[model samples]
Target: MEFNIPGIVNAAIPTRQDRNRNVMIISSNSGGSYNDSGFLSSDFPHSPAKLYITAESDSFDAQTLRDWRDEGFNVEYLPLGDGGSAYAARLESLAKSNNLGPCQSYGIIAYGDAASFCLEHFHVVDNNPEFKLGCLVAYYPARIPDPRGKFPSPVRAIVHLAAKGEDSIDVVGHSQMLGIQGSRRVSRRRLDRGVGAGRALDMAYPAYRYDAEPGFAEHDLDEYDRVSAELAWSRSLAVVRRALMGYMDADASVVDQNTDGKFVTRNLSQTMGTYTAHRSPHVTYMPTLTGAIDSQELQRFYSEYFLNKNPPSTELTLVSRTVGSDRVVDELHVSFKHTQEMPWILPGLPPTNKRVEVMVVSIVTLKAGKICHEHVYWDQASVLMQVGLLDPKMIPQKASERGVKKLPIVGREAARRVLQGFEDEEDGEADNELIPGWYDDEEEEEEKDEQEGKKENTGKKTKLQEEKGKQPEKASVGPETRDEDGQAETIPERAKSEPKEVEA
Candidate 1:
């Protein structure tokens, strides 16, 4: 009696051997692709029982199966149908029938369409399952299905998925949901150029070594770049190996502590004060007391070189400061005038009378207000470039000449211009308004107004004098009364007042 999966596999049942672990290799090709199977068998570092599966095995080679068996794989060819309907059921049945322990099956290595199918349906076999998949390695999957859908099954396994190339399907963007919500430990790899899916697989599993001359894994399709394939292979292998070995990358979280800003500043000032005063004794703690440092050696480093040696003139300008609960981070702009030789600070450089300006950050950890330790950081390249020792052109660093005349406008005005998009704007009418000789002065404007007022007043006075000169002779006398017909009646007017009504 032959033990075979009905409708899935044939009746050829080989005697099984006890194995420590198993690797299930899946492919979508109906005709068993012995090339991939052979490559994987030889490339895998560990000797685990390999199971080669396919969706359609109508043209399955019996000789190939014999070859794999000879190479030592407790192999079985379980054929799955379209839509992957029998995949999950057949996988579970095979595991149960083999009497394998929960951890006996190490991982699944799927390529092409099979890779996509396995990822989508891996959950079906995982949910309410009896076994654990240690890890999953998928190469150049055809299509990622329902990435947004919940896949709580594969969370237990570490997933190492690779995208084909830049132009092709973006594996990272498409599979983002799966990586974030589906798996606990997931990593992605990008193989530049259309290196093909086989190249990525070959890189990870170097089943066969290529000769000096470039050769394609698939000889029929001349689509191989040997250099790219080799680089991608190394990266893929590293990710897969690390995942299977239960190694995880380190992570750190930084929390901003609400510290007393004034106290932190005071402590930092003291540290700089010691440097300025050239007194190592005033330091809070011995330089080499802790942190892989020798106390006596550090004391010599400070007293003999840092303090006593030719300490260059420094003008420290503070840039920013952040105070945490027990730590203080200070960023400062340090200007060093290299007038004397300081072997400790500048190492072997001879005094060149050069002034170098560089930004340095100091992180100080404190306990009970006194400084416990301080770590200072600065870019040595900037300092080197400033001192003319390093050629900025060669290093590709931008050389900025110090003491360059300040812009016509700076500070608040610069900020205002930037906010107003002045850089992109053309010179409008408003630009000329503030230019010299554009508008009149207050004194000139007042003088023009005063001259116009005086001219109008003079014209009015001249008109009044002319009108008086043209007045009648009677108006000049003022006391004489004049009658209508040019007759004088002065005597009657003085005598008096009561007069009868005159005839009409």
Candidate 2:
């Protein structure tokens, strides 16, 4: 929460009274060096509560600290040589210092050896009520604390364990150490019962196992797994926020406002205003590879290509939405008539005067309560098929040399199924119509039409040959003509004598 350097002059260091809480990160590098110049810059002028402590002779990734800063924390670095008794003394001095506000709380995140040290010596803060240590997060520690050991009130703890490589810990053994049967999967209930018997123990302490090697949560590491990292990040963030900030939720209004601006109001400025001012925002339409990066390009896209290009009959219905700490995901069903050239969705295509329907998914990430980036996804094949540009029946089959055949692409039925739901089988549209022999009736009708066409051509040829031998009689044209309904129709003799209308 607060710290006092014993040997250094008090006047040399400026005090940060504005920040009430602090987060101290103790890394594993034994010889890591630290610099405070970047942390004191004008970029982060808001909070001075976060600290990164490392050794004085080693080098580490600076991007890791910058990432924490991007998450709205003011980060600082401290260098301590070797890190043993001196480190413990420094932590003691910080706990005793009066610089922090009375109501403020601080948390710690430790890595590797430092994490092991924190887990072993956690009682330094857990035993003292005056120390304002709220939570502790350990990543891939060499040793774990006793599972049956209880952490007293006002001190919460969690540990992340790697599942593979040398860094992996024996989780089953640990569960057995707590007097439970050794199983491949650790039971939360049994662990809770084992640890929550005493009044001093905290029942909510969590230990998560990631199916990756150590350093999976760090962004700059070679073994970094985004899926694992994100999952762990959400969990760790939830613990820290619960301890310090009482669970602040991500706001969905920003995304809603941005959507309204783009679809309803069609205001370029209003849409752009929803993005974060702190960084350059980007948007990507994944299907057509049409999107904009930064303010100027985005404005140009909205004005010249997107906002005015949508047809008047365009309609968007929200199917579902999921909101997280810093992002929003929306599933939308969009329908429109192909009455105008839409550069965003149907680039370089003329209006086919056909109705189009498709399902779209948009993922919007936010920073500082504003949009940071957007990823829009939709099935382009279904869009093309709905507008009559793509013919599934004419598509070539790649598996065989059977020149050409049908593809599995669908038309408006895909969107219809999504909107109407798939539970009602009887009322739902037919399935697997494109599979061979699935629709035998249609195949029989095609064969019948082909036979009728060959017979008509033979009759015409025979009649021409007969006329050739005669007195050069005028050859009659086909007896059949296609009517408006696309059916064969024979012209009557009375109708042939009728006069045609002239345009003049």
- Candidate 1, residues 267-316: lDDT per residue as tens digits? 32232332211112222222222221334444545544554444336556
Q: Return the TM-score for candidate 1, rounded to 2 decimals.
A: 0.27
In candidate 2, residue 377 scores what lDDT? 99
What overall lDDT goes with each candidate model?
A: 0.39, 0.63
Residue range 15-66, candidate 2, lDDT tens digits: 3121121112122222211111122333533334444433233554575556
User: Candidate 1, overall lDDT?
Assistant: 0.39
* Structural similarity to truth (TM-score) of each candidate: 0.27, 0.61
Give the total clashing residue pairs for model 1: 2
91 in model 2: Cα distance from truth in Å?
3.3
